[model samples]
Target: MNMATNTPLTDEQSTEAAIQRAGKTAPRVTLMDIEAVVTSEFYFTASDGVFGASNYRPISDRSGVALGLLTFCVLVLRNGFTVTGESACASPENFDAQIGCDIARKNAREKVWALEGYLLKQRLHVVE
Candidate 1:
């Protein structure tokens, strides 16, 4: 904690904390493990091409190009399974491709955790 601000120090504010918490309950999934399962990753936008791009790009005085700023990530895993994730920006001024990709990747990785967790549980006979 920082005495000056009376706030907890967030030096270790990361996914590792969540992984540690999961360990307390049963078998757990780590981010690295999740990442290992991903064989390929593709990132795109609503206006990337052909389909959605044909429609009007919505706009607003405050958000500018916000409506068309939806970002998506499609992750192909080792076993031929695929998962998708998405991120959206409320304000175009704050939109960033890298940030969107990071968020979308994290979102997709979360689904892998769920899937892999279930598979592990089943293999361990922890659930019926």
Candidate 2:
């Protein structure tokens, strides 16, 4: 006939009671609310790779470094060649006849030079 003896509140109930008491006595932020705010502004976008919208396109498949160097040259000579700022290095079609072939050849030469330097260093550091 005694409800208290029949079913006593478990530790969880005691914990909840303590929490409610603390809530009433003090103003405090919960950990869960802090976590929610921390995670709210997080994001993921598909354009995170090297060839993202921020980078140049028509990039060389052989070497990304070479492509980046070529893109730099394209940007530098763009104004003189009448290629617009927005179109610089982003679109090959924007490259004027004077700059297109020269840019491509320069990029290829840069790649070759880099490879040669790497090979020279390797040879210099041979164990024997």
- TM-scores of the candidates in the order shown: 0.68, 0.26
Clashes of each: 0, 0
lDDT of 1 at 30: 58
Highest lDDT, which number? 1
Error of 2 at 66 (Å): 22
Model 1 stretches with alpha carbons more than 4 Å out: 1-26, 49-67, 126-128
lDDT of 1 by residue, 47-108 (tens): 56324556554454433354458889999999999999999987777889999988898788
Please estimate how well model 1 matches the true structure, expressed as its whole-model Cα lDDT.
0.76
lDDT of each: 0.76, 0.39
- What digit string (tens of lDDT, one per residue) describes model 2 on residues 17-127? 679977664433333322222211211111223457666554555455334333322222212221211112444446353364455434533443444456556766794
